[model samples]
Target: MKENIDLFTNLLEKKYGVWNRNKALFGTTPYGKVASDLSISSSQFSKLLYGTATEGMYERTLNNINRLIERQSIEKAYEETQLVINKSKTAYRKRIYFFSILFLGIGLITSYLFDFNHFAFKLSDYEKHPLKSYFYPESSMFFDSPFIYNNAISENCPCSGFEGKWKLSESFKLPLPGMKKPGLYYQAKSADMIIRCSNLFDSYIDKGHGMMGYEHLKSEIWIDTKQEPLVPQYFNPSSKVFTESFKQLNFESDPRFKKIADLAAFNVNMFKIHGDSITRNAELTGRLAIDVNKKLAKKYNIDIGYIVKNVLGDLIKASCKTTFNPFCNPNDLSEGISKISFDCVYTINEENLGLNEGYPYTKSYLFKDQVFSDYLPCECEDN
Candidate 1:
């Protein structure tokens, strides 16, 4: 445990140099605040930058300190990236006025044509034709990163400006009569990430089939940050990434069309999740969860997927293999958090390892790595 800290500190010192690292931690940061909270005379924060241990130290202690340091370190990096992404957005400020007027005009046309009454729009024109509908094959499993699951991630990784481990030392407690005991986390380390994405892609049947559907996939990636790992979450809580994406997506689409203009209005929900405060994420979570439930998908009107077709307009045949964030600390917002009690595993280091040992977090540490096979050729076809 402490040995890991030594390596972490060494990496930090190497990046800034001994003189500068000490000056940054001591001179820039308020000295005794963190140490006081832990009731230690010496700065436990020092363990972040200078302390050494010949072998691993206490498991719980290391996790507590490591998560703290992890947040402090990468939060700084994300702040830096935020700055870069911000400077980039200033260039797009001029285009907003031009699009605003264009949208108003298109909105008038779309509301008149695809009005609320057309909410039940008919495809009679297409159904009467021989092609009937264009069948959009399902999308292949997607990953924001270029590498396959379990591939080692680095600073160079795409879509993830992350590379660190997160550990929650103990279960939480409050000033209540029946507070839960602390949790022991022996297996928190940097490893593969399981990304639980919902409603990222929606597909609808076209022509006369008259059907709409939604789907979700649980993809895996290499390493994920301890702070925040959800790819869509990059926009959540509102970062410069959100604004850039807004502009890029609008600019990419041909907004001159009524369909495109109408979509722009609703698609903003995806953007809204990031714009709204984290506490408001309960709404977004409920919405995304519908992608998994067949009935809920119907109720919510979540039908939206890009359709592919051949020149004659038959749904292009494409092969797809099968596959499988949250808010708060995500741990706090997790289903597992609600189930915890004082007598659960938090009380005894090795108590009944309940259903969700790695709540708000993920898989425990083990020698054997969780693996996923690369996609192989398939004979999938359109029915």
Candidate 2:
């Protein structure tokens, strides 16, 4: 643990350079911002550095630090590899140009001597191999350069800025507890847009579908930020963002929607506390559980307790897939859980919330429901 802590400190120094506590609190420093991203407090981060933190905190912090280290290593390696490839490509182009001129001169001499002008001059008419296949191909060949073969990325790549904005649907406050000043802010947005657009561009440029010209493919290159913001439905409490996204459609009238949003906010507030906070979550869940039940019960004027219980129960079961136990003990939220306990639960809760608002189950659509279906794909999968 001490070794890992030292490594983490070294990494911080190398990545962010040295920070001065006299100038700023550790929590307010760029180095401290990393801890904030992991939902660790300044004191806890201090404890982590000094090897005085709990075993769980140590392990979690070490894992995140290791992740940071690994990511940086990969990025550095990629930049180096690209540099080499670019150099090789320049050399290769020069060689190809020299050889092409030599071949053309030889052909012209042979044509003049043998009266084969028809064949030699007609070299310009030789059909060119498709650019996609000649340069970058779906599958690599023996003579292909490292650049061509390396086109496929093992992990998702970020999209170019020209594509459009991919924003998070929900915004959250930082998880730092008891700070005198306002804490950092965060949001949950899609991180895989780059890879998605890359694949799309490959399809377009490669003429994967045999499209004729750029006019037909112009619209496909850009994503409409207003119509489709590419916000994912997953929950990530530690994420911090400096920018804001544009407005999106909201179904604030729905009780379930409000409940899910509130629960998400509550979970973000409770992230990394790992103690009595579970009780607070339980209390919040209890209220939400009752609120949702009451709305359903009053709307249908029938006994919906059993249905609501089963639905939330199923949600809890699904959310606990990574845990030792399959359910959150109402009496003790901290009993057996790992990671953010209530994130996935509320993320999916809004899907069933539409029932309270008089729509069929989320998968299906009713008349004039295209608006909901179009705007919110999470609740309506068919859209």
Candidate 3:
């Protein structure tokens, strides 16, 4: 019994990278650390490492080690089999050369009359449609558009401007928690556009799709402003000199607008928009308003009520109109811009906002208001 226990201890030491001489001398301290690191219980580790017990525990530990050793042995056997097959093939080739020579005289007569090339003939037809032309009939010819190719871009690739230079526009700011200042800003101009988050552009470029749906649009915009503007220039036309708001700024509350506002508010929070004592509190309050408006819109599905109750009623009531400054007053002014810089304001005009130049500034039917022809693809059926 003692000998059997000793044999097991020796095997454990050898298999676990410990010398047989040191197995008995090294106590549970070293074993315990290894066990803890491996996330195994100390009792199981001690029994396996020390061989201090007998019965069921001993058998279990021995079986575990035996299974590991058996796996190694099986792998070694597979390697040996592959080696034997390689050697056998080499020997067979040597024998085949001698056998071929012995049958060479008879093979020459048989090969002369039988031509393999004639049996496998093909004709080149350049006039055929390029897609239909095939070198081999059995080969696959199915191909997909290069633009929507899935493997063309990697999904895990980081965003392009994530680490690049970005400047915040002055007029935009969202309130965020624990921020010393407003968030950073960035814009994606048509020529300057880079694929970063998703492959929407590739699909749009290939298929002539005007733009991806709202979901795609959602992922593309990333705002990191210190105080996300209550009314961003992109969304607000009243602040810009040249740009016009969607002709119907009725403020009649659409549920969709609340969702948009909520999304904007969440972005403000995540990016930490508020800068200091003056700017910080109002933006945060505004973000809360935005969030409340969103929840109310979602719950009631009546955005007009939400806008009236939350923004027009709740927010305006809490804010002091007397202290408001379009420039210095953080809460009163738009989040992204202080009143100082003119360029801080983003406008809808093609000249001011270089990003949306391709999009029409005015409605297609209202082109008489401006001389510029609609460059955006017309939805009209007739040319």
Candidate 2 local lDDT, 274-333, one digit each (tens): 112211111112212212224423433333344334433332222211122211221121
lDDT against the true structure, per candidate, is 0.25, 0.31, 0.29
State each model's C-alpha RMSD to the native: 22.6, 23.5, 30.3
Q: TM-score order of candidates, best first?
A: 1, 2, 3
- In candidate 1, which residue pairs get closer than 3 Å at backbone N, Cα or C atoms, i.e. clash? 1-56, 133-207, 170-183, 171-183, 217-324, 218-324, 236-274, 331-360
**What lDDT is reached at residue 97 by model 3?**
80
Candidate 2 regions exceeding 4 Å error are 1-39, 89-383
Candidate 2: worst-modelled 10 consecutive residues by lDDT: 212-221
User: What C-alpha lDDT does candidate 1 achieve relative to the native structure?
Assistant: 0.25
Off by over 4 Å in 1: 1-58, 72-77, 88-91, 96-371, 374-383
Judged by whole-model lDDT over C-alpha atoms, candidate 2 comes out at 0.31
Worst 10 residues of 1 by lDDT: 260-269
User: Ten consecutive residues with minimal summed lDDT in candidate 3?
Assistant: 363-372
